[model samples]
Target: MAWLFSLSAECGTQTQAELFLAYFQKLSWTLQDGKTITTVPEVMEDNDGNWWCMVVPQGLSENSVKSDEDTPQMREIGNLLYASLWNAPDFRYALLGIEVDLFRTLSELLEDTTIGEQPSNFAGLVLAESIWDLINRPETFQIFKPGYVWIPYPD
Candidate 1:
């Protein structure tokens, strides 16, 4: 928990962090359609890997936001956003995009084996299992913690 703020202070833009925090403080929620709901709609990471709170709609989810929702041309352009973190040679660049509020590359998605094709181990299976678990039991503490995970500075 201390790491959450300490890292934010050491690595983040204060103004941007504050702006996002203000936004996160304002969300209003209701249980919709009885889906599981552990997600909060107000976290973003800077290119520096510091987490900030940005107000996204409660309706947004990783799946929803990750989808190609733009016009066909835009979607096509966005498809270039494809790449994975674990499998790509350029995981560093993908990490940079994550820091900048950009779409994560598929190569990066490969990091979370749970979401990728034919995950090879229990870890990946566990992650995939958690996704469904969150949907089914949104209010569970096991699911709805704030989004704060550390990514080391690139070597």
Candidate 2:
């Protein structure tokens, strides 16, 4: 079963939505067509009355990276790529049918302010390592594929 992360906010405010949009715009991501995405879909309420959005961050795709490669460098690249695409407006909107607002709200609730920031090349590796530690563990993850794991959010 897929686990959905719920935002702490009841019905996210417009201000929150705008902030998420701004954060995504700052990332300056480009689509495969080489066009920059300028907008994201609005936030919506889920079945459980929590605000949420879906995003298929870039590196999550089946072709993103070979999961068999277990090198430190490869793992770092995967994390960085996932983070980058996760914050992209297009990717977020396309996957979730909403926008980055859900992510921003979740980040605030989780006290992870740096979730949207672009990591420096040096820091990317470290961030990747940290990300792996968080999601690669079996206790917190659902088996999505042979080499891929999905981190389930707490209810």
The residue ranges of model 1 lying beyond 4 angstroms of the native Cα positions read: 1-12, 29-45, 48-52, 60-100, 103-155
Residue 90 shift from truth in candidate 1, angstroms: 32
**In angstroms, how far off is 79's CA in candidate 2?**
8.6
Residue-level lDDT of model 1, residues 1-155, one tens digit each, is: 01010001111344555543453344333333342222232445656464443222233233233433322322221222221112211112221211233333223433443433322221111112233343332222122112212222212
lDDT of candidate model 2 versus the reference: 0.32
Cα displacement (Å) at residue 119, model 1: 39
Give the Cα lDDT of each candidate.
0.28, 0.32
| Model 2 alpha-carbon drift over 4 Å, by segment | 1-18, 31-33, 54-81, 85-155
Model 2, range 78-116, lDDT digits (tens) per residue? 343345544432211111111223433323323543333
